[model samples]
Target: MAQQQRATETKEALINAAAVVFGRQGYRATTLRDITREAAVTQGALYFHFDSKQELAEEIIRRQHTMSSGAGASFLASTESGLSSIVRLSGELAAQVLTQPVVRAGLRLSTESADDLAGAAAAPYRDWIGACRILLERAAAVGETREGLDLDAAAELVISSFTGAQFVSAALTGSEDLLERLERMWPVLLEGFVRDPDHPVLSSTSDLIYQSADRVA
Candidate 1:
């Protein structure tokens, strides 16, 4: 039992250390030695749990999606309106990028290692788009979407817009301005497809951004 617990701790330590290094140096530049030094673990210990750098990076991306998607699902479950949930979930994800190193690293690595880790890098975006599609479908059922709105296109647009917003924010300010960016994005992005351009949810954008920014600040 003690050995099992120690192994778990060591593996977790390696994952976290790798994430930090990957976040800073990116995937191609990061080395196993760097990860071991960051983790304060021996090479043998790291190899016991992970076969190579690629495997460690893949694990980080997998856990990143699990954490991100799990939170999105929770936000979806708790909110009453599909539109409202989408807004709130976007804020939460932006906040996570700033606050969670693993998430930030995973997202960064996904882009940096896209060619090498194509499937792992792409999975999170695909899942996020699917989640948005489900939310748009729900909004349509409740008459929150415009009469001629294409749910699939709307879903893709929302995810893609957020992706661009977050990416730009990260590059400009290390994501310090991410929530604010999302707040600015929603109005212009949602104006076309939402049934009501001036919904209460729309008006709450500033508050939502401020509140989430405060939490992650």
Candidate 2:
């Protein structure tokens, strides 16, 4: 058990190191030697855990997918309203992307090297879209989303918009600004999608929402 635990730790350490290196230098410029050096492990040790750099990269993507799914599930479970959950989840995701260097790098790499990464990064996104569709359908059932809103299409749009925004923010102002911008944008986007008769305009209180989400998360 101890040996297995240690191996797991080492693998995680290497993944984290790779995320930093990949985020900073990009996948094309990164090498196994760089990952090993960053992880403070020998090249042979890295190979013992992962056969190739591509494998390591895929593992990173897998880990990220697991993390994102867990986050989404937790948020959905906690909130009664789907739209509210999405608004809250968006903030949570933004905070994570800004704070976690590994996650941020993985997202950036996924977009920049979609072709190079082959379908590694694509599956996670598809999974997220499916999750969003389910959530939107639920929200519609609860009268949270607009009537006649195409659940799948709206979900895809929401994910794509946020993903694109994150990419732009990363490229332009960095992760901090990305989170700030997401907080601002969430209400505006939700307002149009949500079926609130009383509160037609989704009020932007990102700070308050973020604080609440942090507590819930």
Which candidate has the highest TM-score of all? 1
Candidate 1 off by > 4 Å:
210-217
Candidate 1, after superposition: displacement of residue 28 in Å? 1.4
Task: State the weakest 10-residue window (summed lDDT) of model 1.
Answer: 208-217
Model 2 C-alpha lDDT per residue in residues 79-128, reported as the tens digit of each score: 56677677667777776776676677778778788878878989878988
Please list the residue runs of candidate 2 whose C-alpha ends up more than 4 Å from where it truly belongs after superposition. Answer: 1-9, 197-201, 204-209
Q: Write model 1 residue lDDT over 109-208, tens digit each, in one string.
A: 8877899899889989888989998888888898888898988888999988988887788788877788889989987877877798777777786676
After best superposition, candidate 2 residue 195: deviation in angstroms? 3.1
Name the Cα RMSD for model 2.
Answer: 2.5
- Candidate 2 has which clashing residue pairs, if any? none
RMSD of each: 1.8, 2.5
* Local lDDT at 140 for model 2: 82
The per-residue C-alpha lDDT of model 1 at residue 144 equals: 88
